[model samples]
Target: MVDAHETFVIIGGGLAGAKAAETLRAEGFTGRVIIIGDERDHPYERPPLSKGYLAGSKERDSVFVHPPAWYAQAEIELHLGEPAVDINRETRSVTLGDGTTIQYDALLLATGAEPRRLDVPGTRLAGVHHLRRLAHADQLRGMLTRLGRENGQLVVAGAGWIGLEVAAAARHYGAEVTVIEPNPSPLHGVLGPEMGGLFTQLHAEHGVRFHFGSGITEILGQDGQVLAVRTDDGEEHPAHGVLVAIGAAPRTALAASAGLEIDPATGGVSVDAALRTADPAIFAAGDAAAFWHPTLGTRLRVEHWANALNGGPAAARSMLGQEVSYDRLPYFFSDQYELGMEYSGWAPPGSYDQVVCRGDVGKPEFIAFWLKEGRVLAGMNVNVWDVTDRIQQLIRNGTTVDAERLADPTTPLPE
Candidate 1:
C-alpha cells in the first residue's frame, strides 16, 4: 500500500501521465505527485493533430486533456518544458533538464514515441515536414493554407493513418495531393491487402493520387523549399510540400539507461500484464510499453490513443499495489473526410487465418472480422456505428462464430 507521505513522479506529460495523476487523486492518494514534460504546453490529446486540428475545425483549447488550472487545483505539480534527462534506479530519483532532482517511491515512464524521420537528401527543406506534436500540426496547417491559396501540391511520403488523414485535410483545403507507399496498398500491413484496397479506392474517389510499391530515394527542393520527391523508379513527383508518416519509434533512452528490460521486437520497455517493469518500483505505459497481452498471449505494444487513455489508469492502480490486470481489449479509431472507422481486438502477426465481412466492401458501411479456427480474433467497423460493444464482447468471450452467419447482416451478433 502507498503511504500518504510517499512521492510519485511521472516523466512525460502526455495523456497517459495526466490520466495517471488524475487517477491517483481519485483513488484517494494523498502523496506528492509530479509530472515533467518536454513541451511548453500542458498535456493534450494528439488524435486531432492530423484531422480536426490540422483542418482548422478544432481550436487550440479543445485539444488539451485538462485546463491549466486543473493541475493546480488537483495539487499536482507540473514542470512544463522541463524534460527528464536521467533516472537513477539505485536512488529511485529522476534528474530534470534544469539540474533538479525529484525522488519518488513510485515512478512512471510515459515518454511516448517520436515520429520516424526520413534520412534522405533534402529532408531538411522548409516545406518537408513530419506531424507528431501540436506545433508540427500547426505548422502544417499554415503550410496547407498557404499552398491552398497558391494551388500547390502536397506529396505524402507514406500512406499510413497520419499521411491519409493529412491528405484528406489537404484536399479539403483544395490542395492537390499524392500519396506514395512501399506496400501494394494503403494500410496493407494492418488491414491486409483486400481491406486496405478499400481505403485506396476511397482516396482515389476523392481525386487523391497514389504511387504504390514505390520507395523515395530523395526529396528534391529549391531555395530551401520542397520542390519534388524522387522515387526509386527514376520518377519525380512534383510537390510544393511533403509530409512523411513512415511510423514512429518509442522514446526509451531513459528506460534503457535505468537498466529496465527492453523488448527487442518493439524497442519499448518490457512489462508484465500489470504494466510493471522488472524493477517493480517503476512502471511504463502508452506507446513506450511492450506488455504481455493476456488475450493475444504474447508481447504487444500499441501506439493508439485508446491504449494510452486506458493504460494510464490501469498502471496507476498497479503502482498503488492494487492487484489489477491491464487486460482491456485494444481499441482505436480514425477519421478521413466522410469515412470513420473503429477497430478493436488484437491482430497479431499470423494469428488469424481468415477475414469475414458482414457488409459490402464496395459500399460505405461494413464490419470486418479476423478469425482463427472460427473464433473471432479481431473486428473493425467502417462507417458503421453502435456495434463496438458487441464486437468487443464476441472477442472477449472467444465465441465460435459461423462464417455465413457472421457475414450476413440479417443476423445479429451474439448476445
Candidate 2:
C-alpha cells in the first residue's frame, strides 16, 4: 500500500481547485490536501457571476463550490486570502504571499485566468468595471440595481460572451446598455458573422445600442467618475457605467516560475493528455492549462464551467497514479435574454468550411453544425435540449456525415 502521508497542494481557489480537493478525498487518498487561494472568499463557480448573480436571481452563497464547513469536514486545509508567490520545483515546495512555505508530493496549478483590463484614459474611473470574481459580481449587482432604478446608461467594450451576457443582465434590471465592438458582429471570431448577427439582433431588440466596427479609445470621466466613452471612430457615448469585457488571460506566472512549458498558441501552461506538466509531480487544469488533446491533435485552453468541472477530477486521478486521458471536448453554454445556447467541440470560424443549420434560422429553435469536408467539427444548439452527447459523439467519431440529412429537420442525428 502507498504511504498515506503524501501531500498534494492545489493552488487557486476557483472551481477546478475545489473539485480537485474533493476528488482526492473521495478517491480514498489518505494524504494531506492543501488548497491555497488568493481571494478571501470560498471557492466558487464563475458562470453565475454574470448570469444568475448579476440578475439577482441566485443568492451569494449559491456561487460557492461547496459549503464553508465542508473543507474542515473533508480534512482539506484551506489557505484563504493567501496567494502562492513562489514555486520551487527542486524542493517540491510553494511559498505563499504570507511567507508560509508548503511541501507537496504532487502539485496542481489551477490558478485560473484574469480578466483583461482596458488601457485608456480615465479607465481608472469609479464607474468602470470588469466581471471575473465573486466580489466583483456582488459590487456589479448593486451597481446594476442602482442603474436600473435610475435608468442609467452602461457602455460595454468588446462584444464577446461576457459582454453580451452582461448586456442581457443590465437589460434585465431595466438599465440602458450600449455595446461597442470592433468586429462586424458580436462573437464574430467565435461564432462567425452569420451566427453573431443573431446576437446583434437579439440585444438590439432589447434596446441595447450596438456600435459595431468601432471601439473605445478613452473613457471620459468627471471628478473620478465615468461620464462617457470616446470611440475610435471619434464618437462620444454618454455612460453612467462602463464594462470592459475584452476577455481574459491565463494566470501562468506560477507555471512559468516553475519552468513549465507554456503553450505558444495559448498563453496557458502546456500539459500532456494526462494533464501532467514537464515535471511529473506538477499538473495543471482549468483555465490555466492548455492540454494536448489526443483526438484533436492540438492544444486548447477552455475557459468554461465544464472544463473545470471535469478536468480537476481527471487530474486528481492522474496524480494518484491512476491512468487517465483528459480528452474531454471543449464545451460552453450561454444565456442572453430569452435565448439559451450550448456549444460543443472546437470549430474556429475560419477552420470550418461551411455552417449548416438544421432548422430555419428565423425560428426560435435550431441546431447549427460547422463542417469541413463533410466532417462535423462543432455543433451549437439554440433553444434545443438533450443533444450534447450526440453532438460530441459526432465530433469524436469524425464520421463523414451526409450534409443533406444533417440539414434536414425531420432526420434524427446519428447515435
Best by TM-score: 2
The 0-to-1 C-alpha lDDT of every candidate, in the order given, reads: 0.91, 0.93
Q: What lDDT is reached at residue 164 by model 1?
A: 94
Candidate 1 regions exceeding 4 Å error are 1-4
Q: State the lDDT of candidate 1 residue by residue for 88-125, as single tens digits.
A: 98998999989999999999999999999988899999
What TM-score fits each model? 0.98, 0.98
Q: What is the lDDT of residue 280 in candidate 2?
A: 94
Clash pairs of candidate 2?
Answer: none
How does residue 318 of candidate 1 score in lDDT?
A: 91
Candidate 2 CA-lDDT value: 0.93
- Model 2: per-residue lDDT, tens digit, 1-415? 3255799999999999999999999999988999999999999999999999889889999999999999989989999998999999999999998889999999999999999988888889999999999889988888999999999999999899999999999999999999999999999989987799889888988999999888788999888999999999999999999999999999998889778899999999999999999899999999999999999999999999999999999999999999999989999999998899999999987898989998867766899999989999999999999999999999999989998899998888983
Model 2 residue 278 CA deviation (Å) reads 0.7
Q: Sum up the clashes in candidate 1.
A: 0
